[model samples]
Target chain A: MREVFQQSLREVQERLVKIAELVEDAIENATSAFGNSDVAIAEKVIDDVEEIEALAAELDLHAIDILARQQPVASDLRLVVGALRMSASLERMADLAQHIAQLARYRYPESAIPKGLTKTFVRMAALDVEMAAKLVELLRTQELDVVAEIRDLDDDLDELHAKVFEKVLSDKLANNPTGVVDATLASRYHERFGDHAVSVAKQMQFFLSGSLD
Target chain B: MREVFQQSLREVQERLVKIAELVEDAIENATSAFGNSDVAIAEKVIDDVEEIEALAAELDLHAIDILARQQPVASDLRLVVGALRMSASLERMADLAQHIAQLARYRYPESAIPKGLTKTFVRMAALDVEMAAKLVELLRTQELDVVAEIRDLDDDLDELHAKVFEKVLSDKLANNPTGVVDATLASRYHERFGDHAVSVAKQMQFFLSGSLD
Candidate 1:
């Protein structure tokens, strides 16, 4: 029974890693789509989100089933509960990616990065993609150091988010209301993608340390 | 043991209701502050978020303890799991409220609602507050009808969200870039607040119906 429970826990971990990988792909494609205004890649990210959501729902059901049958205690139980949360965060990450992709699709013939903020947005997208990759790594390896790295990446993303706002408000894009709206929404999406990655990292931290702090 | 589990479940329900009540208060105060640009009320909403966060954490701990101690299966298990998800949604709602309040506070002595978008924003804020209240009622009573009502409210809120974008892109606020940024973010925050409320309602539906659909 103990071995079976351990196996179920392993299954949970594998599913989380799988979802995280898909999320990484989604964000990568999303950023590429946003930066280059590639509607095909954007559409792919948008279409693939359902797969992530379905997988997340399936993982959640599996975790619940484990709790029902095995009744894992202490850290084992935390792992299962944390799996549920990680799945939610991963699912949210996919949603944000889709949102980013939609922005690209919305501005198909035009760029979403506005006039003066293209470089800033490019850096922000890179940061989000990097954070998604680190999240996948953390879920697979359980390395606590990766958690801090993810947080630091989020800090940088937040700064870029602020910078996007600053640029939007500056005279550089003063007359382009459409650019202002797109940049505002796009930057917000990129920043939130990083935030959800940090959320997944924090869940991993809780499981590793058995404390949310 | 069954009776003890029942007691624990009741405790979970009560805790969720408590948190929902606080969330209701947060959004109410937040919208008021946002509509009025009242820094004092915004400050209150900001300070109160930590309490909601702490309560949510405590409730999660309690739900996990119940699972550990009683090993509830089937519907009872669903209830506990649903509580965890609902707590997360409610906490997110509180954060969104805080975001709205921050928008108001940031634009102090100046209206966060741009010149022509004020009426639309007022309607959006009203819808959010109504949804929060309905969520509280749903948590307290478990009436499924409230779910449909919340969904309808979200639909209205989403329309207003699009309307805000339309107005932002129009020539109405052509020269006010600050107003454009603030309206964009504030509208997004309000829309997201409604989305989180719908999430909570869906969780309740899952608990009662044994399916997420």
Candidate 2:
């Protein structure tokens, strides 16, 4: 019976890893799509959001079933709870990415970003991808060492996020006022995506150590 | 031993209630302090941030102690976990309020808001106060019915928040560009504070019935 429960739990974890990977790529592709106004990529992001949502639901149902059947105790209980919370965080990240893609359909069809400004956004995306990838790797391999590293990597994202805003409001949009508002909000989305990805990492930490704060 | 664990949990609950009340007031005071340039009010808001942090640490210790002493199962375990997550949310709400107060200090001694748009910020403050008060009431009582109502109340805040930004960018800054940025970010702060307060209400929902999606 315990083996059955563990198998179901592993299934949920595997789906969660897939969800995280999809979210990571969706945001990265959507980030590029918006930067370059690629409609095909934007539409793909919206489609991915549905898949991410469905995966989240499946993970939840499976988690609930395992809980009801096994009545997970101690560390097992924490793992299931963390799986639920982490999937929710990933689902929201997917939604935020889709929201960014939708902004491509807003007015000002040909607003070009200043040279090299997309670099900051790309870095932010990379940070999110790194965090998501690290979380999945940690969960799948059950590597405790990676847990401490996740927090350290978070600082680089914070630095990049701040630099993105500073560069946006100062150098990039000093005189180009037409789509500055949209660009400003774009910066907000990037930073928030990074935050939510870090949240996934933190949830991974909780699953491992059960010291969530 | 179990009775003592219950007592600690009860004390933590009471402390969380106090923290909620204080946070509600802090959000109100932070915005009022911003709109009015009231240094004293800003100080009060900042002070509450420390208090909330201290309470959060206290609650963390309480959770640990209860788990160690009682080895609680079933509903009792869920209650402790939910409380831990709720207090973390409360601490975050308080931190955001504190940041708003800090922003207020930068806008003071300037009277920077344009003549016509100050009323919009005042309305924002009123919204903040309304939601904050409602959340505190819900936290104190832990009623699911009230939690559902608070969820509905967020729609007004959402509309107001959107309208405030629209007005600000369209013509609200025709005269007072000096304080326009300050007013813009401060209004965002109030809108976000309302969201956080609603989040606390949502956490209360989880504790009440275990359904918050």
Candidate 3:
């Protein structure tokens, strides 16, 4: 019976890592679609989100099942609960990526990003994708060091997000108001993608350490 | 033992309602503060968020405790899990309200909203508060009618949010880029506040029906 419970726990962890990988791929493809106005890629990302959502729902039910059957105690209990939380964070992260893809889809043939701010957005996308990949690693390993790197990448995304706004708001830049709105909102999406990665890392920490801090 | 479990479950519901009320109040005050540039109100809202956070943390642990001890099955299990999800949603709702307050506090004495968009924002705030209040009632009653109202209100908010962007991007309206950014992001915040309320309502429905649809 103990072995059965342990196997279930391990399977839960494995599925979580798989979900993280799916989310990571979505972010990378979505950002690329955003930068290049690649409608095909953006459409694929949007279509793939359904699979991510289904996986998240499945993971959630599986975690709850573990809680019901194993009636896990102490650290084991925390791990199951943390699985639920991490599933939620990853689900929201995927939604953010979908939003980015939708923008790319909405403005097909014409990039949502303006010319002057394109480089900054590209950099933001790179940082966000890097963070998402790290999230996959952290989920697989539950290492604290990986969490720090993901947070640092989030900080970089925030800085690039701010720079996008700076260029749009700069007197020298000649961005129209519509383009400015698109850039601001898209930057926010990338920045929020990083934020969710950081949040998931924190959930992972809480699972391992059993500490809210 | 059953009575003890029942009492614990009721306490969790009460606390969840309390968090909802706090979040509702935060949205109301945050919006008013945003409109009037009232630093005192904004500051108070920001400070009050800490209490809301503490209450949410307490509720989560209480639910987890019920899970560990009672090991509730069937509907009881669903109730506890629902409590966890609702607590998380409400906590996030409060954070959104706090973000709105911070924007107001950051731009105190000088309103974050521009002149032409102020009325639209005020409407969005009114709708958001109404939705938050409905959420409180829905949490208490779990009635489907309240959920519909909340969804309708969210639709209203989404419309207003689009209008804010339209005006900012229009050739007729003259908005400074900074003010535009503020208005755009602030409106997004209010719209998202409505979205979270709708999500919680869905969670409530799921709890009662055991169906995700």
- The models' CA-based lDDT, in order, is 0.91, 0.70, 0.86
RMSD of each: 1.0, 4.0, 1.6
> Candidate 3: which pairs clash?
none
Query: Candidate 2: which stretches are off by over 4 Å?
Result: A50-74, A112-116, A144-153, A168-178, A206-213, B1-12, B39-44, B57-81, B106-116, B171-184, B203-213
When 2 and 3 are scored with TM-score, the better candidate is 3
Interface Cα root-mean-square deviation for all models: 0.9, 5.4, 2.2
lDDT of model 3, residue B39: 95
DockQ, each predicted model: 0.81, 0.19, 0.58
Better of 1 and 3 by DockQ: 1
Candidate 3 stretches greater than 4 Å from native: A173-175
Per-residue accuracy of model 2 over A111-204 as CA lDDT, tens digit each: 4344456777667667666776776687677777776676667778778766754655564444443344455556666666767767777777
lDDT of 3 by residue, A76-179 (tens): 88888888888888989999999999998988888888777878887888888888889889888878778779888888888888788778788644436667
Best by lDDT: 1
Q: Pick the candidate with the highest DockQ.
A: 1
Give the candidates in order of DockQ, highest first. 1, 3, 2
Task: Indicate the docking level reached by candidate 2.
Answer: incorrect
lDDT of 1 by residue, A105-157 (tens): 99997877787787898899889889989988998899999999999999999
lDDT of 2 at A26: 85
DockQ of 3: 0.58
